[model samples]
Each structure stands twice: as C-alpha cells, then as structure tokens.
Target: MGSLRVYATTGLLIASLSTLVHAAKLEDTAPYPKAEAGFSRQVIYLPQQSEEENFKVELIAGKTLEVDCNRQRLGGVLDEKNLEGWGYPFYRLEKVIGPMSTMMACPDGKKTRKFVPVVGDGFLLRYNSKLPLVIYAPQDIEVRYRIWSASDKVGTAIQE
Candidate 1:
C-alpha cells in the first residue's frame, strides 16, 4: 500500500514539472513586435531561382515606406554619394544599367513597351496598415534590402 502511494506521488510530480517547462518555453519565444515608424535592414537570399519573392510590411499612418535592394557580392565598393544622388540604390554590379522596362500586351492585341518605375531591384511605396510587396530576382542572387519609414525621408542617406 505504501509503495502504491509513492508511485502515484512521483507520477503527479513528473506531470506537474512537464507542464511548467512547456509554459516557460511559450513565454520565452514570442512573436516579433509590430513595426512602427522606424528603419530596418534585412538581407534575403534565395537558395534556388524563383519566379518571384514576396514580403509583407506594416506601415504606419502618414508615414512613407521606401525599400532599396542592393546586390551583395565579394568585390566592388558601393558608392554612398552616388546612391544618395540617384535617390536610390542602383543594381549595377557588372555594369551601370538602368531600371527594368518591359512590354505589356493590351486587350486590343496591341503590345506597348512602357517604363515601369519600380525595377526588380527596389521600389518605394506608400500605404497604411499591412501590405504585401513583391520583388523578382535571378536564381541564387544575394540581395540586401534597406527599408525606411516616412515618405519625405526617402532620399535621405542613412549610414549602415
């Protein structure tokens, strides 16, 4: 009878300890805090080539959001002054190339080549609350991004 009581107590103690450990883990790892008005830098590189990559962002009211995509390579130094003068970073690793332009087919079967402001490299957007942004890149390209909050501060250079 005494042995039976000891076994029951030991089982209860083990269960209680397990529950406490689980609760502690939950409290330790919490979700990321919602972004407010601030600047953040993130590097995103895909393992394989993909058609498109999407990123979600939360923008505060009356604040503008600007995203700059910089290709990361071993050699070559990024020109801070040139980037500031150009208003944004240019994806010119091999050579100095401009933004991407594509031709779109109209409903009337007419093809028109128009200049799209945002390239595969980077873009500037304005919105309130949460929004999804998409970017297209080549396979296995190492891309670094700089996100800024507030519209008027778009061209302002930030040292990071």
Candidate 2:
C-alpha cells in the first residue's frame, strides 16, 4: 500500500508539472499588442448560394470587427465605411474574438471568413504575415482573389 501511494504521488507530480509547462507555453504564445496604430486586414466570404458579394476589410488595432446575417439582404460597415450590398440580407459579421497577433491562409487557396472558427475549423488558416490575403467563400462556391500589397503589411482590397 505504501508503494502504491508513492507511485501515485509521483504520477500526480508529473501531471502537475506537465500541466504547468503547457500553460506556460500557451501564455508565451498569447497574442501581443499590435504596434501603435497597426492594422490587420481580413476578407469577407459570402456563401455561394447567397446573392451577397464577398468583400475585403481592414481593421485597426484596438478595434472590433463584426458581421451578421438575417435572410436575403446583406448590410454592414467596416473601418468607418458603411456599405450596403445585396445578398442574404441578414448575413453580417457578429464579432471577432481574438488574442491573435498573426494572419494565416488556407493551403487550399480559400479565404478566411469571420464566421469561420479561427482555431479548429476547416477554414482555419495557417498564420503567415507575409502571404497575399484571401477570404474563403462563406458557402460552397469558387471565388478568386489576387491581393496587391502596397506595403509589407497592407494590401489592396478586392470587393465584389
């Protein structure tokens, strides 16, 4: 009984240490604050069957992004630009929850939409700050984008 207790205690200590190490790694990787006035761009993907067109968005640091949908008409504003477009009238970005400091892309040439899960969804992209920006089609439709970056960190947007 004493040996079993010792083994259990050792196992518990190992588990505790492992958990601490994992937590430390996560903390180290936590998103850092963006450089002053820094901004990140995100592409909006519309569902294929929907009439709404895909669009590009630029978000400044310390700002929140949101999109939402209702039925057949789509409407939303970004970066102080209010846009009215046709499509699923209610489709709009709700919000972007982030501690993210990087951007990523899908290997399959799809863009990342705000509605898609950034961590564990099929649309989750591999983070890369250097690649051309692209937004995936919100639905099953094929759309192509060729973003031209004016600077290392900014790109010309394509809106349809």
Candidate 3:
C-alpha cells in the first residue's frame, strides 16, 4: 500500500509539472506590441448559416487582426503584401471572437485547412505560411486577434 501511494504521488507530480510547462510555453508565445500602424479599412462579410453578416474593419500590415461575430465566419485575404519566397517566423493567432478556421491555397490549386472552435474568448492560432495566411472564424460572436511577431505590434481593426 505504501509503494502504491508513492507511485501515485510520483505520477501526480509528473502530470502537474507537465501541465505547468505547457502553460509556460503558451504564455511565452502570447502576442506582443500592443499597437501598430499602416492599416487600410476594408469590409469583410461574416457568413452565417442563414444570412451573411457584414462588418467593416481596418487591417494593418505586419500585425494580427480579428473580427467578432456569432454563428458567422470571417474570411479575407492578406492583400498585396506577400509572405511567399522568404522564411518568416510562424504567425500565431492570439484570440478569437468565436471558433477559428484556417486555410492556405497555393496558386497551383493545392490547399491546406484546419477548423477549431473557440472555447471562450481566449483561443490563439499559430501557423507558418508560405503564402499569406487566410483565416475564417466560424461563430456568431465578435472576434478579436493578436499577431505573434516581436518586430511588429498586433494589427488593429475597427468593427462597423
């Protein structure tokens, strides 16, 4: 009985330590540079199962931005700025209004995709893109996001 108790205690310690390490890594990767500039305003549609909901926002270069909506999905391009042909740090999504979905389409028609529900308002996405990362938020709530680049602040976008 003593041996079993010892083993159980050891296992619990290992599990707790692993959880702590994982949490630390996540904290370290959180977005930074609270502000950014060089943004242009644009209108994006959050598609709903019933009807398409539209929201206007300002997109800044080199920063992360997010849209908010519920039962809706946000979809848009990265504009003229191209991340192709150069190695860049993996971009991460810091938060969301709802669930998050991502897709990358090659000029040759190949595509990569992922879908994850936003558990709360604190979900983040991380990706390394050969092309600009195109994202979709599939929920019916306001979306928010942060970029994970040390050299640039998180992108700003105003909702309309």
Measured against the true structure, the TM-scores of the candidates, in listed sequence, are: 0.19, 0.17, 0.17
* Stretches of candidate 3 exceeding 4 Å from the true structure: 26-160
Model 1 over residues 1-160: C-alpha lDDT tens digits? 6965675466446534543444423223233222233322221221121122322222111111221232212222222112343243222222222333234433465333322222222133332111112122222223333222232234767899
Model 2 residue runs over 4 Å out of place are 26-160
Q: How accurate is candidate 3 locally (lDDT)?
A: 0.31
Candidate 1 lDDT at 38 equals 36
Local lDDT at 72 for model 1: 17
Q: What is the descending lDDT order? A: 3, 2, 1
Which candidate comes out best when scored by TM-score? 1
Candidate 2 on 1-160: residue-level lDDT in tens?
A: 6965675466446534544444433224323222222222233221122111222213221222232231111222221221234111111222334424334433555333333222212222222322222321223222222211122356779998
Residue-level lDDT of model 3, residues 1-160, one tens digit each, is 6965675466446534544444433224333222223322221221111111211112222213342221224333332322245432222233334334444433465333323223432233332221222222222223333222222247879999
Worst 10 residues of 2 by lDDT: 46-55
The TM-score that candidate 2 achieves is: 0.17
Query: What shift in Å separates residue 12 of candidate 2 from its native position after superposition?
Result: 0.4
